[model samples]
Target: MRRPQATPARVIVFGAGATGARVVRMLAESPEVGRVEVRDPDTARLRRTVDSCDDSVTAARGLEMPPDADMVVIATPTGTQAAAARAAVNAGASAVTTSSEISETRELLALGSLAAENGVALVVGAGFMPGLTCLLARAGAAEFDLVDEIHVAKAGTGGPACARQHHRALSSLAIDWRDGSWTRRSGGSGRELCWFPDPVAGRDCYRGALSDALLLVPAFEGVERVTARLAATRRDRLTAPLPMMRRPHPEGGVGAVRVELRGRRAARRHVAVLGAQARPAQGAAIVAAATALHLIGRADVSGAGGLASIRDTGRLLRAVADRGLRPCRFEGFTLSRDETPRP
Candidate 1:
């Protein structure tokens, strides 16, 4: 006798923007997903997204999620994600959010108990920086005996909404976790030179109102310092306080994230660095899609949390790499025999 095939998952994505469209396409390609629906207020955008995907994909006009959906991917703008997530969980569907905003991430984390009660998972910060960065941090931390500090930096933006959010983030107050306390600093004030993967190499990064620390601190129990920064230009810092002078491009250029971990390994100070480069929207979409698939396959994952809370970082990273967002690790040059120092 042959075994019966399991029912495919029904996934609903909110937003027909760059990331949302990409997520729909990815999910449509997955054999595990049976139906994919995209919802957005903009009818034209919604139609375009649905038309771009496979025939199994459909378009919905509003924010409401159907109760039958197995998963809901919230690719909407930052402020709008929490509500969609709430509705999805209440309707008994697992939820995934790409939101990178601090406040919004906090709001989503608060849904942990609700999601657990409903026996559904809520994965927050499933986008590029907070998503991939968190995974890299966990991967690096695993090599350390005691991680003391984690610093994450990113370059470039995704869609227009992402560009706008980056602008606002530079103007808002930046938060840092230090010495078991939170510290606030003016955004764009602490500029530091950061080296990313090729094509986005060596840019000036500054403290920003990013949510990486919120996601990472909880995952790593004894980590004392955590900070996140964004690559910015002199003009970006100068103009951050003012309204955007022009409409952001429909999509930005190559974006990258660099994660650096400092800790003690074998009683000696050690550092591990990992990074990846891609179009921000594409990277975000890949992470979100991979996360949704992981959630679908794993019945053991239930509750709301960021990528840091994920049980299997290695597996998720491998899946993301398999999807083409390959991560690069920084391995310092080894000493030659001739160059070895005598004790």
Candidate 2:
């Protein structure tokens, strides 16, 4: 008797814009992915994405998830993510979403019981900042005895949709987790100087209506303080309240995410900082692709949650690094014994 070969995975991606197209290309390259289909309402954009990929990939104009799809990766606009995710679960396919919008993330999380009942996994915020930043926080938290505060900051946007979201994030109200309570503040009010990895170094960041805290809080138990910020320019802040004046570039340039973990270790204070740099679209694609693969390949993963819900952070981070989004750690700082506080 001859041994049987395992079947390859079938993945459907919704949206063929910058991040979606890149996701399709990356999924097509994986040997585990047998068939890749990309769907977009825009025919021109769909055709361009399919034309750019290899022969194994196909294009469709419909947004519905096919029943045969093993996994559905959604890179559509933030507003449409919830509906698409529900469709994916209804079709009995695992789903991954790259949405960073707080409201959208909450909507997706609300589908947890539905997804769990159907035995499908729904991974939310599987993009650059919330995605990778979530992973970094989880990994860094493991190094400390007690994690007290987690601050995440990101610099840059990916495609036009991302740019628009970045603008809107600044204009919306910001949410922060402080001392066992949630507080709302003006998006651009809390200005802080943040240092990202090189190439995207030292940019002024401000509190934003980002989804990091919402996703991270549930994953880490008893963490006191959690805050998220986005890099912004003086012009960016001034123009945030108004509609975009001009068309955004087809794709933005280099982007980065910095995760800082503060806690105690062996009766002493310890801090760990990790960061990664890549084009926003590229980084998001890498993280999303890795997440889809992991979700599809594993039988143990189920339920709907953010990247912080991932059971194996090391495995996912290693896969992401393998795909070229290697995370870098910052070192060379010593804690002073008398630096606790001054009365």
Candidate 3:
């Protein structure tokens, strides 16, 4: 368990756009973080972001070498984050990011390792789905004698503004481990899809979005069956989130994480509905809160930087428990009276 050092803290936030704006706001409210450096190339935008912060936050263009920064969070686009992380690692700084769990190509392994070897941890996929979702999966794995399988499901009508900005890195992708080699296929895998029961729509299931499935499943050495599903609810005026975008959501959207565990005693499972239709902002806030806990060393983090699996799903869920979310059990085709999925 890492402990907060002291106040007058300093953090460097890359891309002070919307997500950066929210992150900066969260840090400002924290008594532990007193100073923040928001970095972006746009002088006008950076100035606006900095002005929004109390005297504590300073916005600047061209990120200087992080000489005295305490924590470095890279919320920039994926293509840019790898380079930014390398720079941070070279500067001997700790980093937290929601950047698409290290790309499936293992491209940034060496750069990320540099941070670890330097003793500065770089956390990846620290956002809602992969970040907290993975954390919960880790926790569920803890309860079972053997985590014979792990399934991750998440569907969003749209991503937060910050996510949309980094669409190249954020959109769904097909990935899973097989025979020791990680493989990438199309997003819509040809698996026989079963309907995940729903009240409004009823049994809607397609190839689950493959965002985290490709990056996380392999992390749990023994787990064989891992599914990452992505679904969306739209107003008919809009279409599915494209395979790419350049900004996080301006409004917001809802999503959920469900983990199915096959235990020896009795098949047990835990389902958490986070980020719902009615309150997308709250959903993003829930994820942000979980990320903050991990950032401040308040909870344990599992897996390396590429992508985050909260590893302690129970713990992560607990962190966001205040979001008015709860766990419900499910049977084959029917959800018990008490087992309604809020999202």
* Model 3, total clashes: 29
Q: Total backbone clashes of model 2? A: 0
Candidate 1 vs candidate 3: which has greater lDDT? 1
Error of 2 at 174 (Å): 0.6
> Could you give candidate 1's per-residue lDDT for residues 190-309 as a string of tens digits?
888988999899999999999999998999999999999999999999999999999999999999999999877766677888899999999999999999988885667789888889
lDDT of 1: 0.90
RMSD in Å for model 1: 3.9
Segments in model 2 whose C-alpha atoms lie over 4 Å from true places: 1-5, 335-343
* Per-residue C-alpha lDDT of model 2 across residues 112-203, encoded as one tens digit per residue: 99998888899999999899999999888888877889999999999999999999999999999999999999999899998899999999
The stretch of ten residues in a row with the least summed lDDT in candidate 1 is 334-343
lDDT of 1 at 83: 91
Candidate 3: give its CA RMSD in angstroms: 6.4
* For every candidate, C-alpha RMSD to the true structure in Å: 3.9, 3.0, 6.4
Q: Assess candidate 3 and give its lDDT.
A: 0.53
Highest TM-score: give the candidate number.
2
Worst 10 residues of 3 by lDDT: 271-280
| Model 3 spans > 4 angstroms off | 1-4, 101-105, 157-173, 190-211, 232-249, 263-303, 306-317, 322-343
Report lDDT (Cα) of residue 36, candidate 2.
97
